[model samples]
Target: MELIAKATALVGGTIAFVRRMNSPQQQAFGTAPEIPEARKQGIMTLKMPAAEGWKDGHLPTCAPGLKVNAFASGLDHPRWIKVLPNGDVLVAESKEQAGPPKTLMDHAAQATMRRVKAIGKSANRVTLWRDTDGDGTAEIREVFVENQNQPFGMELVGNRFYLGNTDGIRVFDFTVGDTALQGSGEKLVDFKPHGHWTRSLLASPDGSKIYAGVGSLSNIGDQGMEVEEGRATIWELDVASSDARIFASGLRNAVGMAWEPVTGKLWTVVNERDGLGDETPPDYLTSVVDGGFYGWPYCYWGQTVDDRVPQDAELVAKAIQPDYALGGHTASLGLCWMPEGTLPGFGDGMVIGQHGSWNRSKLSGYKLIFVPFKDGKPSGPSRDILSGFLSEDEKLAYGRPVGVVIGPDGKSLLMADDVGDIIWRVTGA
Candidate 1:
């Protein structure tokens, strides 16, 4: 019976693959053939040397046309970053652990003797940096908050600073200009913890509600689909009422969300379900309509259903497919909609951080992409704005970009490089 089931699954998957090959969406699978190699051409390019404990103060000059500057460093796995109104930068440094070594030892002995060393004993905190004296270097460094469990996304709503941690949403009565963040915050929503514990939080434009991105509890539905209440969906919570409800469903792992400036619609970048193959399900960036269903664990990228899981034929028919599908396994993160009329070159653009790929055999997506938005929607193909974070030889990737925002200066772009442990500012010369 097991053999029969496996054979049936294989045949079904083959049929699905063939059907997808013939579809128009197949054109979206490969990288653009005309994408020129990105030249290093900016006034400055800042990098944090990873070898030096990934600390804040290592000054190094990059290739010509790139200037290297340093912000606050000495952080452990900093995930998401936000620039405040006062030009100070707030970074959420995630805690890190060294797991047991992969070696041939007595399994029982290894399990018993391995002591998991925790980094960031003093790092359950968010740190702020400011260039106080106008020397183009950060002079003031301070801790914003302490004892938070793996905080990721952060937003400023009025006088309150909202944070999305591994557990839930938290708020603090803090201002960007305040010297210290010493106030206790109210917990907005409590989420059940599972796989991929980091949650990305954003607020609606009017500050009436909060949007939290909850990733899938498992990779590709291995954890069983019955527990579907909190996994792989964005939950909308009322700020004043603290009432929570599902805003959209069927997303595998939506790590980033932003409010589009032109349309005021909620947009998200999703790290889609993986492990059918390297290129099975493409990661996506889409305008998330309220009450919309994006196919996950059941169907992906439209009508291609997963053969590993039994399909709900009724539900599959109702899922609203994504608007823009990025290439497979790109690990899309840190979405920001460029304010419509800000930059002249970019009429209205969507900037996405492609955190790069580890699951695939081939290296792809170690750069930032700019998707032009016409009127209020995505138009044309996404172009590479920042590149070469990875070595051209593909032997090493020095940085993984996780968060991006229009800098406080309103002309430059601020990006968080998690692996490189530096905040980079890209400005047009």
Candidate 2:
């Protein structure tokens, strides 16, 4: 047994060394990242941290003049958050479903996700928490709705509440002060489900239209473009007529969407494709344009063609460049606008929750970041609002932040830690 253990350790060390040697040296982040030439690999790099739940006073590290605490804990895979006008917080807790592995890369990726406790049976529910006294912690916790198919996004438009489930949009009757969802929802629009299944929903300012972000069915259309029709695009749905159309296209996996108050334009954070060397193309944050394409299988970063993909010169020529880069493989997920006074010493900007990286020899993200905006555009370097999600050795992660939103009071920040199963509140020290 001792000899076998030694052999396993030696093999692991060699594999880690190989990964380090193959990883690109430079990091691609910020508005003008240096996207290097593609270095396609026969086998993709995979580095998933082991899961370790927080215990005995363990918490994330906050930036100077800020503090972090658990607002609610002991939940199950809470991935998204929505704050109601009446001060109630709703959390969407869902689990990932892994499909059968079709290739060597797929097998390795699925195995890593499973080992890190990421994929499992869907929770299929959203829970509501109330803090009536203005304290950071919740005093009331209960199920707001249940029996949904992997719900991710939630929006309340007047008396109607909309949910973005894996397969469709569901509308429920809701009141501002209500504690529980009253009935089963009505299906508003059907969405294709499977690969990259999250459907993030956003409502227009006038509440007359809804936009949904749908990811590609496979990375770079490896499963054929026929299976990718209507995927990798944002869909705009007319509320009154229930008519839906593609608002934008060619975004690989646009997850988080928000309206920039100053510009009155829609913005989104996209997760780019993997397998091209560590820094070949960076995930990005950009203002979404109506009838625009942002490049998927054919190209990236404004017509830098991906040679591996089957060529579409016309489509590549039409691909619009993203506004800013958010670091390669960072998995930057949650985004919300922060007003100037929301956090002391911080000006108006956007707060991003990065769930960390998996396909790099070294990790990136795993914290909440603030990108300062001036005159409606990113003005300076990103700052860390919260960190220390990973352990000192980087072998284990205590938590991973996903959804982010300003509390109803308009001063504090609420973040969802999916691995730790806790909602963390951030406030001025």
TM-score of each: 0.79, 0.96
Q: Per-residue alpha-carbon lDDT of model 1 for 158-206, expressed as tens digits?
A: 8888888777888888866986676678887887664666688888988
Q: Worst ten-residue run, lDDT, model 1?
A: 40-49
Residue 288 lDDT (model 2):
96
What lDDT score goes with residue 304 in model 2?
93
Candidate 1 structure, TM-score to reference: 0.79
Q: Which candidate comes out best when scored by TM-score?
A: 2
Per-residue lDDT of 206 in model 2: 97
* Local accuracy of candidate 2 as per-residue lDDT tens digits, 286-396: 999999999998999999998889999999999999988888888888989899999888999989999988776677779899999988898888899999998877678
In model 2, what is the error at residue 354, expressed in angstroms?
0.7
Clashing pairs in 2: none
Each prediction's Cα lDDT score? 0.67, 0.86
Measured on C-alpha atoms, candidate 1 has an lDDT of 0.67
Residue pairs whose backbone atoms clash in candidate 1: 44-67, 45-67
Which ranges of candidate 1 are over 4 A from the true structure?
1-69, 95-122, 134-136, 340-344
Candidate 2 Cα outliers beyond 4 Å, as residue runs: 1-16
